[model samples]
Target chain A: MEKNKIRSDHPLDAMLRTDRIPHIWCPGCGIGTAFSACMVAMQASGINLDKTVMVSGIGCSGRGAGYTRLDSYHTTHGRAIPFASGMKLANPELNVVVFSGDGDLFAIGGNHFIHAARRNMDITVICVNNLIYGMTGGQAAATTPCLAKTTTTPLGNPDPPFSLPLLAFASGATYVARWTILHTRDLTKSIEEALNRRGFSFIEVLAPCPTGYGRKNKERSLDTLKIYQERTVIKNGAHPMDAVMDFGNSITLGKFVDHDRPTFSDNYDRTCRPHFA
Target chain B: MKPAVLTGEHFMTGDVACAEGALAAGCLFFGGYPITPATEIAEHMASRLPDVCGTFVQMEDEIAAMASILGASCAGVKSMTATSGPGFSLIMENLGLGICTETPCVVVNVQRAGPSTGLPTLGAQGDMMQARWGSHGHYEIIALAPASPQELFYTTITAFNLSETYRIPVLVMTDEVTGHLSERVVIPEAGAIKLRHRPAPKGRKDRFKAFQPGPNGVAPMAIAGDGYGIHVTGLTHDERGYPGMNVETQIEMMHRLTQKIRNNLDDIIRTESYRLEDAEIVIVSYGISARSSLAAVDEARAQGIKAGLFRLITVWPFPEQQIQKLAEKVRGFVTVEINLGQIHLEVQRCAGSRVPAVLVGHPGGAVITPEQIVDTLKTAF
Candidate 1:
């Protein structure tokens, strides 16, 4: 029972704390790729590991905090942001990051996500968007593509899906980007850039749940990775004016938005200057 | 070192004392909403916490406020939130979360009348039972009552330390009267204060279990960023921080959780027995009404009725053993509170069939009077 083992020479071998392996994720899952990208991003940022914190909500993706070597929190569902927000405010020196999923981050935690962005908190958020809920056996998720089959929606997804990058931009994130696990390099780079940004920065990493979502669609891990590779078209900076051009029936992944804004903590401290000497 | 004198400090209120106490207690994060008479606490905390490199946030609602403090606590900072009946009601779930997760934090309830918005800005001790049983499930809580601004200042410090020591949520339960009253509190010298720290793990990192009980029943708790690989969940969990649902895991975890408080009842329980040494009748009271009972007890003693006062500082765990001991010596019990016969039931239980219990109840915002309590004392005699 090696639950979180990562073999050497694997793409994630360098990125992981091999001794801490036997991750909380199930076998043949795509979350390992997302976690690998996260590790690479932290290393690339040159930030001190001592000052880094990873916070996660309750889900399969939420376990990212537990398995990661960095200081981490496994908080309640949809509450990772407020917890991370408090941590960031308590110690402004820490580089805080939130790892949550589409269902946990969007549906139940939708209010917090928008508010965290509105506050323009200076923390990076990497949402592992598997397009389906994998933890509870592939339930219908907020990011599930329209016309897809799931346990709850065995007939076909009737509701429309969100363009998460656009939603992040609308919610006041200073940096917003999207990438699939297959594009590890770009995903890792986007995460690094998000970490360095001054205000709220969000990277939606599209991962595959080969066990739940993939099994339902008769798609294996290789098939799911190929699907992500073929469907995604990278745009250096997608324009809001030509939003329709950037988004279609396919899953669009790229560096979608980048702008500077006063971080929530910085502005809050500035506003309460007399109180915070 | 000289204690901070409250001389000529213009009209300081009890809620303000609580805010100042929190600031002095090294509280660097306050997440709360504005609800009277608890609003002054938030206002003062907002004004003060920021001055000390701390942060104060008026969350979208009380749930966020409660959840935010839990987050702040995990980040290795002393944190707190203030609310009245309704806001306190909103925080029930998360308060339980804090308890089960062993997250040390403070919740101040400047209680107002309520089932739902009973009497805003008016006093009521109706929430005494709610403070103990508001959150679902079984667990122990430490709630302190302050009769004046002086006690409010001292009790807030005690509340934080209790929370940190036992790794449980501590409630500073005050009513509208005491919370709103303006009085002088002699702030103790900072050097004189003894703060409690959560027991930290002693051995190698791999040996640490977030829920493993020490000899005292409390486990060593490391903050999230301390890199202890600690895991906490609202779900029933084993000592290793993994979710546990089996009969054995469930039984052992919960037994330890409850014993963590019950086993250390001597240190955790606090009360003051005023002149109970040779008294024939004992008046049991707490919160604001206890002040009036004290006056009535003094008057009864002067008139030579042999009456005394027992003021419960730690309201939960109910001081049952102390009550039993007092019941043996005293002829009868007179229970006086702003609430109508709530704590009277507890008094009846602890007194058993041996001692008679008389309740002087007040069902509204108005407090119980000493004359009313005196009448009950007469009946007990």
Candidate 2:
């Protein structure tokens, strides 16, 4: 009798660089769920894998770029957006994605986030909002909910967190959506749609950090997912300003902005093509 | 189609000449911010890049501009960015990223006086040491200083070529005087101008190690769309480009990062020696001050003093060996720069206690006068 094969193939095995498996994500961390959804969406979207580039800044989610088998860059802290912008503008044929954390994207890289969205650069930004700086020992991030306990905010976070949907909508993102890690199917669909959309599509995924945010709040991953399932209210086509999150009140989940406009490269070609000719 | 090289003499400022040289060197992407003395470089590139079917992006800030150029270069396009003092300070963080990832790009710092925006409109050589050590790491950098508009044009092209050849971020350290000064620059024909192309990766894509060194210690590069599946990061990474936090990995990574340039200094360092044969007093300078030093040298020679000017074209590898050899023969060294003794420290280090190294510099609102340099030389002797 032949020896039984121990290795089993999975659907995402092709999409990931399996050699880099056993990733550094903590047990019950929601980044893996969000990243898995992104991978599934990438597979479902039918974009050319060879022409896809993933850029990430320094954080836990920054490691996503390294795990993906696609051509990826783990850039410096707070620089993924501009790096992705460079790739997209240099070759419009490529599908560029910026995948990083809330602290990396909203705090240190906030200026780039707004400007890239304002320019309406053609790129998909999947920001995983874990509410705390998970990689750096649970510091209060810009997206940390008010009154949330973090390492830095030992008592409670006094500062109000940014409403990501409203920020993206105001910054001129063509498509903006919000979802929790528990809503994997919905998040995957949003990512697929954003990947197909033309200019500056943004999706903010509220992920759980069992080791960081969860530990401080004394909540497990399952408990947060349960809260997300109970509290999330789907409001498609809702106004971005009405979608602000105050976990004590309610969690709004759906596409908040969907409108088309000329991207930076589109405008560049329209104005400069005659001169080039 | 517009030719890449202009191939004729044209009156242009050093900043504009630097842009033209970038075009002639086949730089297809320029990401920059508008800063004084360097603004004309971006202004010229804005109009010129589109005509040549190149990409030009005015980034939100200097940090983004620096990051964008690195990204464009990783995408298989030769890229560059230009900025002044304050912007140069912002670019230092990502400059380290460029060095760590071994990305090939040219960064032009048209120097202005500043610890913090001191004199944006005036020239200074304050960033000489900053260009070498501003990035917060132990890494070797290649910096070239141009003395005139003509030299800026050629040196810009040389900077790009050297960057590609070494797979490192090369700095074209010019000054506000050199940048704004207008002169006749003759751009050679496209065929006559030498260009260096980065070596393409050759092997199995899955098995390729992104940080592995070749014969010259430069790992072959692959663009994003290529099937290489390369992962580039800023952490101390192994040959496979995976982050390895151990001291052994850091030692190996740092050795490769620094030894490539340090081991090949003979090919990288370039300097111009004028009237140095049997001269008792040597004047060391670069950028605009070098021109002043040369003029002072002529004056000193006319006055029956054995004075020679040693102008640094490539300022960073410091040319320590040459300075060390000259330390024995020369009676003393007089260093002239717009900044307050930045390069003087390097000269002093190279020329030990045996010889005196005096500095004639200021806080840098104006140029160092040739008379001051001559007086310093006479007093030191």
Q: Which candidate is the best by TM-score?
A: 2
Quantify all predictions' global Cα lDDT against the true fold.
Answer: 0.82, 0.91
Range of the 10 consecutive residues with the lowest summed lDDT in candidate 1 chain A: A240-249
- Interface RMSD, all candidates in order, equals 2.1, 1.1
What would the per-residue lDDT of candidate 1 be over residues A115-219, giving only the tens digit for each residue? Answer: 889889888999998888888899988888787889999998898877777778889998888888889899988898888888899999877788779888787
Give the range of the ten consecutive residues with the poorest summed lDDT in model 2 chain B.
Answer: B372-381
Clash-forming residue pairs, model 1: A3-A22, A4-A21, A4-A22, A4-A23, A5-A22, A275-B50, A275-B51
Query: For model 2, which pairs clash?
Result: none
Top candidate when judged by lDDT against the true structure: 2
> Per-residue lDDT for A1-277 in model 2, tens only?
2557665787899889888888999998889999999999999999999999999999999999989988889999999999888778777788999999999999999999999999999999999998999999999999998899999999999999999989989999999999999888999999999999999999999988989999899989888888788888999999998996767668999999888999998888777656653
Query: For candidate 2, what is the DockQ-based docking class?
Result: medium
Q: Where in model 1 is the C-alpha error above 4 Å?
A: A1-24, A137-162, A210-227, A240-248, A274-277, B1-10, B200-215, B224-229, B232-252, B299-306, B379-381
Residue-pair clashes, model 2: 0
Q: Model 2 reaches what TM-score against the true structure?
A: 0.98
